[model samples]
Target: MVMAHNPKIQEALDARDALASAITRAGVQLPAMDVRTPWAADADEDEEREGDARYALVHLGVCSASVAVLLADVIVRGLTS
Candidate 1:
């Protein structure tokens, strides 16, 4: 089944890509980063549509403790500088 084009999903994908690029430049990696599909998890792929449902979320996923500290430091430096 071919699903209709969903701009919302595309937006989420674009955001994920942009964020991943930015994080790479930041010298960190989020191995599990992706778009959250809880809202459409139970639906068929072709049935995934944006209606009155909530928009998909960009999952930042997890990182190691040291990576977390590094991210925090990067954020802090960005904020202060």
Candidate 2:
């Protein structure tokens, strides 16, 4: 669906986009959590790798939050329309 047709969804998407842009502008280079799994079952990795995993978790958290907003908007629209 075209987000422009729904003002509330469009606004939410815009906010998410702005947040992602702001994170980029802050020079925090986050990896693509959507493409890669954020964690592993084995917990024997080195400290650096663990740190990277933690960072990926943070990125995933942000991505999940944005997705939740979008999903909620879509669900609400579907039910209401």
- Highest-scoring model, TM-score: 1
Q: What is the lDDT of candidate 2?
A: 0.44
Error of 1 at 3 (Å): 6.7
Candidate 1 residues 13-68, lDDT tens each?
A: 78999988987898888888877654567776666655422356688988899988
True-structure Cα RMSD, model 2: 15.2
- Residue runs of model 1 more than 4 Å from their true location after superposition: 1-4, 40-54
lDDT of 1: 0.71
Candidate 2: clashing pairs of residues = none
- Give the per-residue Cα lDDT of candidate 2 at 69: 64
Candidate 2 displacement at residue 80 in angstroms: 43
Candidate 2 TM-score, true structure as reference? 0.33
Report residue 62 deviation for candidate 2 (angstroms).
Answer: 6.2
